[model samples]
Target: MSKDYYKVLGVEKTATADEIKRAFLKLAHQYHPDKNGGKDDKFKEINEAYQVLGNAEKRKQFDQFGANFNGAGGFGGGQGYGGFGGFQNGGMNINMDDLGDLGEMFGGLGDIFGFGSARGGQGRRREPQRGSDIEAAMTIDFLEAVFGAEKEVTLKKKITCAHCGGTGAEPGAKIEECPTCKGHGRVRRVQQTILGSIQTEASCPSCGGEGKIASKKCSECNGAGTAYDTAKFKVRIPAGVDDGGRIRIPGYGEAGDRGAGVGDLYLNIRVRPSDKFARDEYDILTKKEISFTQAALGDKIEIETVHGKVELKIPEGTQSGTVFKLKNKGVPHTSGRNIGDHLIEVVVKTPKNLNKRQKESLKELGI
Candidate 1:
């Protein structure tokens, strides 16, 4: 009897490829045998369903003739779907592109199943490899964070050697073809597996995928092809960038091997706290000390804001924690579209030390 893969994965027959994949991952996580209470048989069943429905061509055949169409018997003897036959002859061909980073879900079973991870195949030559990313931290003043500033940061890192120009060879050395891969930059090996003899290609270890090697090594860098050097980068800090914000400087990371694509530099921003102002997202908060008489009399006073000093009116009978808003006096947005407001929290100061005349006057007024 044909098994309904859609029912097994808890999906409709009309489910899209992405929908099928999502269902498979969810069930795979639950039934994975490595878990504390994993169902090995259920995991295998889910994998089988995904193998058919996850693939476009296989799904088409399965939809037309039922899931049993691709079974060992096949649909009325139409070559038996050749499902594991390819594995029996050549090897199992797994598409690493579709797997993406989801291969991590398999975890300990990665080696057993030969899953290509984020680094892809171990032996395959990484054509145009991406460089390694570098992380750094920068501390800026509160006002600088509110307004934006450009600052330079220096770092000591590996750079291409000036002597050999990253070739790792002497100026006049003889370059020979890689003997390991025969100038192909890759070597193929056949391994016996449960499926059959699987052929795999890996980068040439001798030449490091360059297909060539130098007879004499570079003297200055000692054949490392790189040297320790200092580099300075000017980074632009955006306005209203909060603490722990990251700034990415593209192509400023470590140099790639043999002129491959350069990686990026990530700058973690650390904003220092202001003595007079506190920020809440885009809004600026400040505290103003007012005399008790001023709160009762309603007087105009000057308050310092990020933009400048502005006059704020204290209303009559104001409470101790009265709050006032100053429109457009806060930080300007990084997008330059809108600005935030400045909020002032009033703290009234009460007279504690009283002279004889002041106490007598207050007593008279109260009476």
Candidate 2:
């Protein structure tokens, strides 16, 4: 074999399952492509090693045959077969469309174990699918985001048809078993490919895989069980949620096809700029201007914070651009446990015009 999985993970062959898992996790964190300075090649190598060695049954086979084990009883007698000999079995007909979904793992000489139908327009239906998730951008004021607020949002999307009650059948319509696939929801098809003729089971086209048909379709949704409608609801914006943050509201997205399941609605936050305040994460930033005398002589002044107004003491000889932190005065954390500090930047304003007497006051003290 070209690579050793145990050596790649820096673990012994005799390592326990927990040890293998820990080693994989540690290396995965260090080389994950999402992290800074991460190496993609190394990450892929680590993942490949773990895929075989991490499984109990696969590991047992790997221990016996090393990395080159490929089912087929280890040696290619009646075992591995030539290129497409495995397809000789009546149960192993390949679906050419789903072949792309298999990717490099099973591209050339491998066969999918059992009944397999990858996603497609006429593919076999295994289970009821959930509706598609929807995302929308929501703009809120800075203060409204700092402190949670309730706002209304108008959404235009698919909803269950009121007339049909999501059944795709009009009230009092006669429902009968589909005649095309004999109520099986699927039918067999033989297609000619480059490899040869491949037979696959597909969803019945007449009934759209429902296994039943309505004598009279719903007029509102045209028998699809869903219709486009407008809905308005109030959403609670969480406190301390930063701009570009996403909030998920469950069961608010488009209704699922044929009433299968609903999806979630995601609101992407966009905070409007504030003229009197700025933000650095959870901290609230505000600038306060004071006269030169207050900076030199010291004074107690009121500062406005997100919570409310509070008094702050400026020490004597305080310089311009000095920032004071007010503990627990900034925005509340989304968790509601921790509160951030309010940062106040003091800007000292110098007197521009001075009278002769005012200027001479400094000279009189010297004279």
Candidate 3:
């Protein structure tokens, strides 16, 4: 069935160019192949879908062609328009002048698909690729999050075997072309349907889609070219990085087979709760308790800041819930801005127990 491009991009068909760009960017960031695990095909599909729908002229042609537009064939296969088999096979005979700006769009898709003009020849496949990215969660102390700290984390991941150099073969061993797909890495299955013969291509199961078979497999990786290793690394928590913020550590994730670059590691941060202070942007909030006598008769009180103890004066008759702001005494801003203010809320504490003599003295003063 023909996929709906607008639906793929999560936008209406009548969406404007700006709206289409915004929607594409959001979804692209969400499902980018480098970030989203187990969704690489979906990411590629949406990117291709948006490439055609984001443009006006291509959209018009696509709307005109309806379901007959063969994205795999790079458009112009007219099973919808007046029986004009559209362009010739291999998309070679299509008139470049008619495609207009779509040439660039197709060119970009070709880069991803490794089309004829790409480094690989027609139907030529590239090397085995990197593994998908993985996400992990880490918790740090609030003070560490504010001041930035380095931590060592250990995770079990697959890494290319050092014994065989990721080729999955014994030392100095040769690789032979796969017998299943005959070095194609993919095999076509033709289904005889009511309309005609429909061919579908699937990865070759025998060679695992690599199109090459190792003569002797490496004992460590068992021919998969990767092994499980306990990866340990130091992760730097940047100052002022808030909770739920992500830190991307590239090339520290799972290793790829056949010397492919390692996948990326994503750390989802969680800040531990602070007992004495609360964070608000770059500001810190705290509570201070004072005696009723101190509030009634103004006095100097000592309070604790992240820095140290500081003396603050309380005015006479100071009410409860009064907030005092201390400038440049809060968390540091990541952008190098001035330190935020410290907000201290004062609460007057009443005496809970009094001796008989104290009670008598109070009664003599009041009664």
Candidate 4:
């Protein structure tokens, strides 16, 4: 059956080589069997299309022949088979060497083919990766959050093994080349996929990509290079750190493999709710109940703030639910530039179940 390679890859005939490759990778990743809803037949079609249109000479010949561009039978070349191979078992077969500059495109696709550690598209070797960041939750009281406090956190984490000196070897151990990957630290593989035979590379598993093994393993840490132990570290809780705030401590997380960089420790701050106060940004909010007499006649009342107890004056005939502000009495700013104001909401207490004498006295005063 005749096939349009350009249409299969969703590219125009005038598409450049890079554009053709980009389109093929997109479609390939989209329809890969390992991915969800991946169609095997569609992936095969995309591979077939790219095998022809992705190459410069093959693309030129494909353009010339319009749809039937078999270099061996249709274009001459006999049983020599040209550079491309015939389809077998409903799969398009092609020479791996002919796919020039494909190392980058096929890199990291190793997982799909069960290939060893694959390099990135850039073909650069993977370096020692940093340890993962650790997350911990801390609960501080409202006052502590406002005033800031230094507290100790105990955790079990991995650290560089002192016995191994951050190395996997024991004291004065000889190093030898790995036999699995042949000292290359990575292994190459040719895998049969819906796209055809794909060439991929991956890090060696036996040596953990180090390409070397120690003659004597560290007895304290086993063969691994890190030690797992419990440690207590002091963490400063900064002021104005509201709930859900996070503080990062660098190089305080798990130690990296070998001698690589360590990870970070992140503390998630959770402020305890205050019985007498609520917070808004850096401000403190509180409610005070004022009696009917106090609301009718102006009076000074004591209100509890984040800083301390403060006096608030209620104006004469002050209505219920009136809000008052106390300057510089709230929590301090995280930036230390300014302090927030303390907001006091006044609520008038209505006297209920009054005595008969009190009710009669009120009636007489009104009359």
Candidate 5:
């Protein structure tokens, strides 16, 4: 038996168009494959129900036929009703002329059918599809991260083909109806279940469910509609971007197929190990070594900061483990208004070797 479209979308048969759409959107967001742990089947079900109920003509037909009409050909041999179009024993066929007008229709249908479709007309079919957000890891020098820097990275990804303009067909070639789908682009298969026969619809494999075939394939893309390309992108690392911090670069990811809008890129930054410095959110920490004599007598020492080297004065009788703060020398705030500070930790070093004259002088002074 055919599933009840109203029940699938959790709406009444007399529900308004807006109501149907709201229910579908709610369910679709919940069951989306990316977020829903591989629940593609649920997503497909929700999309299919919406396709039938969302349209006035299709809903009328479904309400009247209750899966009995099966459109023009019946279960396995007729054209689908109300724009359902292609259904054949072997496969479905699609007409290229119909492709331009079916974007909204097919997009909604794809939601039901577990696929996605592009929008627009031939030669101008691209839409402003939201770019997919991307995530990547980057490592920078600790000092560079504190001060901020621009980095160039190479990424390999699938991009729309320039040769055929992402149509997968040669320029000036004609499109023909698919013999398999007979211009419907779909097929029905009946299975014997415990409750008797159950019919299911699937995309036509021969024409890849577009229901049309190209007479000549594009040479550059090999009829795949997309090609692999290497891209170089410039990413900006902010001063305060620490380990595990994320940076968003708008529209710098894989291009959508067939002139669809580009996706965004995200960078997950990881600071490289530093030999001389460590970092907190916006503060830099470094250990400074001082001789025991210098610690007792006090001295001027040069310390490295994210900006440059600065002189730090140690007070007389300073302790071995004293810390000094250098103002406005650490990472810049993301707000771009102020900078952080640098912390210097003092460590007194004892002499490892002593000369005979040094030893004799020390004995004369002490003993």
Candidate 6:
């Protein structure tokens, strides 16, 4: 039976040339043998269909003869349309136009497949690269972490060149196209594959992807597009941030090469412990000692909190390990929206070594 190229490429007979090309490209990307879940037979079948339908004259002849037409036009003298027996006898003929598109298709996927260089180990392009990220350790007092503070940090790293504005060109230098790639930023090479002779493209190794070079190098950065210097910036620490917390400062990291973006700076915060208070989440816990007289008679006493010293009422007959809450006396929220409470634990101190006269007076009152 004659093959239907239109059904093979999944396009209508009235489909335009661009539509047919798009369908072929899409299917080829899906069934490329190198990709996962791709079948070799399916890939060859799609390519064979495109070989006929992709050509105008062949498509017209196919439309006239219909799917059952196996005569002898494009399929090599009565070999029939459905017979791929030509595979054993070298039937992998690809069009030059499709070859260029295929090269472009593979060229854009260099990063994905890590296709560094071409055949014979050709050098790869110097692609634009980002700067390295920075991490710094910071130690702050407990109060500072609770209330937040701004601190200055100093770092020594590469910074953007002040001269020539990171273009790597001197005050008066001529910028010219890359000699290697001829300003195309990419170079094409032909290779023989299982699919037969094919052309593929890669980034220009000499000039990178910019395809441009400077005649004179910058004096300040020496053509590196960046310089080394000490930089200092203030970092804002938010409130209620616990120990082992992390703060991110964006774009403050090392500068990228060839005028790319900068990286980030991460601050690892370590909060010092307080002597008088302990913390649980956002709440502050403190222990206070009260005399037995004060606990029995119900007296007001000063208690220490993260916020400040506050008055706490000791209720009558209060026992040891009794807890009291002071609202809004703990840590403040990072957003300043709300505050936590301060938990106060009371410890009663019993009077000891009473006088004998005082003991006898208590016995007489009981008699």
Q: Clash number for every model?
A: 2, 0, 0, 6, 18, 0
The 10-residue segment of model 5 with minimum total lDDT is: 87-96
Pick by TM-score: which candidate is best? 4
Q: Write the per-residue lDDT of candidate 6 for residues 122-149, one digit (tens) a residue.
A: 4433554577789999999999999999
Model 6 TM-score (2 dp): 0.65
For model 6, the stretches where C-alpha displacement exceeds 4 angstroms are 1-112, 118-125, 162-165, 184-211, 219-222, 353-367
Residue 24: error of model 4 in Å? 2.6
Q: Global lDDT of each model?
A: 0.75, 0.73, 0.69, 0.75, 0.68, 0.74
Model 5, global lDDT: 0.68
Ranked by lDDT from best down, the candidates are 4, 1, 6, 2, 3, 5
Each prediction's Cα RMSD? 5.3, 8.9, 11.1, 6.2, 10.7, 7.6
lDDT of 2 by residue, 1-367 (tens): 3567788899999999878866865676667666677787787667656665666765776678765655322333454333222222212244433433442333321122123332333543333456778999999999998998998989998888899988778889999998777899877766552223557765665576778978887888777778889989898888988899899989989887667688889999999998878899889899999988899889999998878899999999999999999999888899999988999999999866979987798678662
Each candidate structure's TM-score, on Cα atoms with residue i matched to residue i, is 0.69, 0.65, 0.55, 0.71, 0.52, 0.65
Better lDDT candidate (4, 5): 4
Mind giving the per-residue lDDT tens digits that candidate 4 earns over 1-367?
6678888898888899988977887787778877789898888778767777877877777898886664222433363334455433223433322232353466544345443233332344234456778999999998988988998999899888899877767888899997767788766666575555555555665566788878787888775667898978898888888889998989889887666688999999998898888999889988889998899888999988777788888999999999999999988888888899999889999988999998999889892
Query: RMSD in Å for candidate 3, one decimal?
Result: 11.1
TM-score of 5: 0.52
- Could you tell which candidate, 2 or 4, scores higher by TM-score? 4
lDDT of 1 by residue, 1-367 (tens): 5788889999999999988987887777777777778797787677667767777887887888874565423433355555533323424344333443454654443443343322344654334345688999899999999999999989876667789887768889999987767899766656564425545555655577788878887898766566678988788888878888888888888776545567788999999999989999889999999988998888999999988899998988898998899999988887889899999999999988989999999899892
What's the ranking of the predictions by TM-score, best on top? 4, 1, 6, 2, 3, 5
The collision pairs in model 1 are 123-202, 123-203
Better model by TM-score: candidate 4 vs candidate 6: 4
Give the per-residue lDDT digits (tens) of candidate 3, residues 1-367.
4777888888887899877866765565556554525266676666666666765767787788777765633453353322222211111111222222342443332222222232222443334558668889999999888888899989988877889888778877788998768999766554442112324455555565778887777888766678888878898777777788788888888887666678999999999989998988888899899987888888998878876778889999999999988778887777766677788999999867989998898789782
Better of 1 and 2 by lDDT: 1
- List where candidate 2 sits over 4 angstroms from the true fold: 1-90, 93-129, 184-211, 363-367
